[model samples]
Target chain A: MIHKSDDPVIRCDGVWKIFGARASEALDAVRSKGLSKEEIRDRYDCVVGVCDASFDVGRGEIFCIMGLSGSGKSTLIRHINRLIEPTAGSIYIEGQDVNALSARELRRTRAEKIGMVFQNMALMPHRTVLENVAFSQEVRGHDVRERTQTALRAIRAVELNGWEDKYPDELSGGMQQRVGLARAIAADPAILLMDEPFSALDPLIRRQLQDKFMSLSAEMKKTTLFITHDLDEAIRIGDRIAIMKDGVLVQIGTPEDIVTNPADDYVADFVAGISKLDLISAGKIMEPIDAYTRRDGPIDFDAWPEAHPNQSLDQLVDLSIATQHPIVVKLDGRPLGVVTKNALLRGIKGDTAPAASAA
Target chain B: MDEDTTFNILDPFSSIDLGIADSAGGIKQWAIANRDLIQPIKAVFNDIVTAIDGALNAVPPLVMLALITLIAWQAAGRRTAILVGLCLFALGLLDPNAWSLAMTTLAIVISAVTACFVIGLPLGILAAKSDGFERLLRPVLDLMQTIPAFVYLVPVVMLVGIGNVSGVIVTIVFALPPLIRLTSLGIRGVNPSVVEAARAFGASPRQILLKVELPLATPTILAGVNQTIMLSLSMVVIASMISVKGLGNEVLRAMGRLDAGKAIVGGLGIVILAVVLDRISQGMGQSGRERGQRHWWQSGPVGLAWRLTRARNETTPPVSAAPRTEVQSN
Candidate 1:
């Protein structure tokens, strides 16, 4: 699920997007000498969208960009597709400069390689579900039979097979979103740019679609740049998460990395509501079994609490409360380490383990 | 040029009978006095009406009926096509001049609205694209729509000298605002997220307009067309003051002779056309026209929509189609 290759599918470097008549000048001033966002806005009458944002999304990676409204997460995602051309800096998809592409080349790249899903799943009301799904193919002049078959497959993938002939207006909000998802994947593009794709849905439906998206991304292995204000969603789906503040990228790391070791107070406040249970694993906080037994006198062979090395802190807490016995951390049924009472308490409290192993 | 003859054709309300002063001129005075400003504008309408009238009348009545039926069928269902066919046929049989006159009126409406769309669509698109342009157009459109149709018609007839051309010019002035207003409003009202999706998916500007913006904006634009047609039809009897022949002219003649029966028949003709065109255009504007369970024999555009509606009327949302009950094993 996590792709850690040297060659990333999408790379953006030092991207700055300023919105004003003198945007370039404003950007230059910001880069040349550090200026506060308020100062730049007051002095130059320019609004910063994305300021010195840089990141790489490895192939098949779900790189979630998370920020609240006006945080420039949306603006940053638009940069990958060159929908908002950068004020400065470069974007390369498989090493071809996206900003440098001609209009035709950009369109071709968008059509063949990128698919985008938006928060507003306003599937074309005039078109049937099948037609909406097959739109990209139709635009590409693909033959009817072949494109429809592809669209049908995509529809079925989203569990919308029986409703292909229904217009978007007739479908429920969640169903309409599924149709949108089907439309995006119908083209089978190499990249997916999802801009808060599930943000509009009810919480129940949102979770359902999020689960569906995770599996679909795993199956399709499409490199996805997912944008969301919901950190829970980012933690659920992203292999790596980038947190933005104002118009700047403040931190980028795995969900575990962010939760356990937040980059700053802003990111800490953002991740504060996030539960530590899913993020902190036994492998991250366990002491070696030999050291544990030597310190604690002896291990009970029969009464010990056993957990897999990857078990979450919440699971360990449950096990700890269920019994007074120390927890045995086993990998493939062989005891690799121990989760003592002290270690269990620290894990639940989200305290960084001493000599923490990079996981 | 005589007041008695002019009085025979003027809207009854347009004439005021003030004793002693003899102020019978009423609203007509404004038009007469503004002749210097009104003539060139009237001349333009005269030319438009002439060109469209000649082009439409050149086709035989049967050919015209067939073409109208074809368009009706495409826009609506077979019911509208058949209805238009019957109306056209009945008009020809009831009065030999009826068909020709109807065609003339039809030509004028067609030219005015087509010209409206041609001119209005670009302006609408521009208005939608630029906020300043839209703000600027709002008041101008409001003025175009708010002016009394008869007041404008008086000026047009007085300046253009009352003919098919002058009648059409008046109709154009009456019917144009909605098309421009709705086209721009429709484009502006398009869902931004949908447009973003199209752009994100690599749709060129032209492709987005054709496939996304235009299709999504269609219902509003079609509504505009319907309003324009209805408004134009409403102008018929009023327009006949210019001596333009049509069902409107028949009504005017009946009014002059004080014949209610002739007026009724002529009014009925306009009503029939109005209903038929309104229903057909509204049907086209409605979505889900072709997205229902259908019989295998469903064929042409009208047939497709017809059968689909018929089939839909007989069915409910399929309960068995609920796939949500499936376990999320994936």
Candidate 2:
């Protein structure tokens, strides 16, 4: 199951968070004596918020955890940033165990390495938009001038150029979310954790913000863990989607994989109504396009211009559409094969093409 | 105590009492001459009494019952108003003069309490805004409220000495607490959010208090005013002990002579006054709540006077306005 990839920027291992009075004892009983679920419930009166959940978030990936309310998606995301302490687990961010850090160190880690955008926007009502955007930097003891300059730039980056002087209440819901995003990024943290940030907004505004967020992420290339209940949103933004049910990680895969090959009935039920053909892309199913192939008039150099063989079928389709030519897919800059529009369409439709195989 | 301290405070003012000594001396001569006038005055009083009696007698028991029914209908609803009306009829029968005495006592107490409210509210607001000033006056208000009405008499008798002024002063002392307490409470209880909203936009504390807090707390504060009026009414009988003429003195006279009828009449009068005043003030408070308008005029004479002065000042054109117009024209 190990994919050929770089080491994950973030990793969580056997995370178990039980909430109740005798949580520690229940955890011990389960670990040492292998207590049954009923026995644990009877003895400790506990709720297993996160039970043995593990995942790795790759660098520059918009990894989304999709779940219904109370599905521990938020809790799992919070554990990575250490906003909430896990009962029994280890979360490593950039090779450092977050749980082993002291309170000051945890705060410093949050300040320096992680940025969180809350669902509620959680902007301090007392402050103006500019001040809220600068709060994290201010908290890190940056001088007023430095933080203010950083905040102004971040605000501009979020397309909130004119709203710096306005209070949180003065702005509409969508604008406030932008402010929240700007505030999260103002300190330039390495990773961003968003917990249902756009759920509170209107549909049109949510879509607009989602598009903006994708473009921003593409530019910034920060590793992101976005928790959302909306399935479509997860598909739209997440590079990898993790589906959770009742505190257990049900399935973790690309959106195409989740749609085509769900791990269990639960995952199947989730992706049941979705049109798999539209969701799957050529890059997800195509072999690398051959770069050195002899082709008719103007080989559209950008179409299959040197890329790894593992570039997803979706990326290949996107490149095919962008370059508007038959793609010469490359593996390590060597021609693997050629994938034309028909082959891409076939790949998108879940067809196996022998001619479009990687070299 | 020195001899001078022992001497009554009123002694020096005895010279200003022009009519009393002469009237006492001439009482016998005047009575002999005005014997004819006495009969006519007595006749008028008898006629009035007969008229009242006739009016009561004319109403059938059924009519009285209906009247009671109507009262109950009006007060809280049909039932309570009817019950109250029946109670009133029973009280009227028990003591005829009680109604008039009660009305007069109520008027006096209400007037005094209204006077205290007029003075106390502004003082409370002023104190609330200034911590040092509020601290300074807090002890004084505590003593005023806690010290018995009779204890106030010791100083009041020393100063003004046993009359309506002294009675009014004592009533003010007992009734002033609620006005101060409520004004402070109302001022303090203003929604912090609303206040912050106002301040965030650059409103001063005074403006915030007047525009936001005071308006919001009016109903509760008016309730305090209602309690103050009720307390003042309760003190009427006690105030009468100091020679202040009212139903209380009549009750005192009845007690001195052991006359059950007279005592009952006076006590019933006080009760009637209490009920009537209670209804009116309670009605006013309800009306205030319904209107929900914090207009200065609705507050009372002080607010009315403030508005009048404000209006007068506003009538005059400002020098700046004239200059601005000239500049614009130029």
Candidate 3:
């Protein structure tokens, strides 16, 4: 699921956003005096919205920023499109510094390179679904027939073909969000900025949309920076997840890296509610077959239940339950490691013991 | 001395006169000096009033009634159209001269409302976009709304000179604040996230205003327009004091001789026109909500024609399909 590129589609380097008139002064203090967010607020009356956030989103990578409310995950995403300009630092889209661009060039970058979807599904209430979907292209002054065709294609992609003529208010919450997605993709932008786009939906609808978006993103190979308060959602679809807390990114890693080794208590608490059964892979918790053989006697690979190295913990649990012996984790019929019951238990507990030893 | 003898709070400054007359005289002098610029602007207003009044008068009274009723039917609905038709008919029957006067009054109101939008829409948009502009406009709008109409009446009459153009100018001054305030409110009330989405999608400020914000704010803006129309109508009668020709003049002349019966007729005429115009404009605002609900060929007179033609085509023989094909090929 991860698409690694040497030149990332989106790169934020020490971007800081402080809200209020004294933001620049506060930013100076932050750099020189290392003022805490509270001290900065008290002294300068400025709230640190995003503080020194830096991340790279590779081409086609779904980089999810997960945090609780007021964690500044939303603020961090806005910097990509320059909706809220960074109080300091630089953001590059396709290696072009966003902040350095002139207003016209910035607009051009937004129209040609980036599209954003909002949590509230901010579709124009007066516009039909088709018009909403076609908005970006229309703003770019594309010919009516051309944009309409593009819009219809996107609408069909989101499975909103029949509802294209209906206004946003006429649609249900989930459907309206689908229109929002369609609108973003209709522009065919290289990067998609989604700010908690499905967080407002019911759980079932959210899951459905997440699945739909994942499939669409994969098929289209759209590099996306997704903002969400839900850790489960980040773990579900993100190639890499960045956990934000109070304007700072505390952790950035693959789902397995995050769950097994949370950087601090904040991230650990956030991931505590999330089930690791699906996120942890057999490869992650498996010990090298040689290590298992060194500890015990020679093992017959045939006696143990076999599973792929990529098999999730949840799947491995089922295989473990069916057999009394450890499971052989293999890749292309070559045994790579073994997942013993002890290792499996530690994995389920989200303990890094097995993964740490395996590493 | 007065403060020492009597317990008067403002005794010391009571004898001092503010330069109120001087400022008034200065403004008058400025206006007189700016006649070259004001003349063209005054001509534009005069032309609009004349054009509308002439066009309205060109139509026979019964034809005008039917035309307005038809318009109400399309813009509002059947019930409102019926009410409008009945009211116009009643006015004509009640006062022999009511029809012509009503036309003139309608012209003045239309011109004034148009002027209000011309002056107010940009101000409203400016207010919506900038806090500083809104802060400045807030007090001005308050002053415009709170100051008595008669307070500015003399100044406006003296500056613009007494005529239909001056009447419209006065009416615009009276009717404009609500349009500006409501327009600003409507634009401001647009979902911020929606505006942000537009910005995120790279919409220019102009595009966002036209394609997203303005369209979404239509119902509210239309409500503002409805208020403007009502305000203009009320002001039009008072504008008769400055010799603007309208139903207001009819009432004014009737009142001058203390002709109670004639004044009653004229007053009733004004009431009937107000109700009709008010309902029509209000209905238009209401219909703004249903704007996207129907097909383009399912609403107006075009829709009526389309429906009739479609019905005929459907009922006709299959042979008609050949002609349609031929027409398309041609």
**Candidate closest to the true structure, highest TM-score:** 3
TM-scores, one per candidate:
0.76, 0.47, 0.91
CA deviation > 4 Å runs, candidate 2: A1-7, A32-43, A277-279, A282-359, B1-330
Lowest-sum lDDT 10-residue window in model 1 chain A = A350-359
RMSD of 3: 5.0
Candidate achieving the largest lDDT: 3
Per-residue CA lDDT of candidate 2, range B121-167, in tens?
Answer: 88778776777877887898889888878655655555444566567
The two-chain DockQ for each candidate, comma-separated, is: 0.51, 0.02, 0.77
Question: Chain A of candidate 3: what's the TM-score?
Answer: 0.93
For DockQ, the strongest prediction is: 3
lDDT of each: 0.81, 0.71, 0.86
Task: Write the number of the candidate with greater DockQ, choosing between 1 and 3.
Answer: 3
DockQ order, best first, reads 3, 1, 2
How far off is residue A331 in model 3, in Å? 6.0
State the lDDT of candidate 3 residue by residue for A1-359, as single tens digits.
Answer: 24446689999999999999999999999999999999999999999999899899998899999989999988889889899889998998888889988989888889878988999898887788988898889888999999999999999999997788776877899999999999999979999999999999999999999999999998999999999998889988899999999999999999989998999998888778778899888888889878877777687889889999888899999999988998999999999988889889888888746546544
Clash total of candidate 1: 0
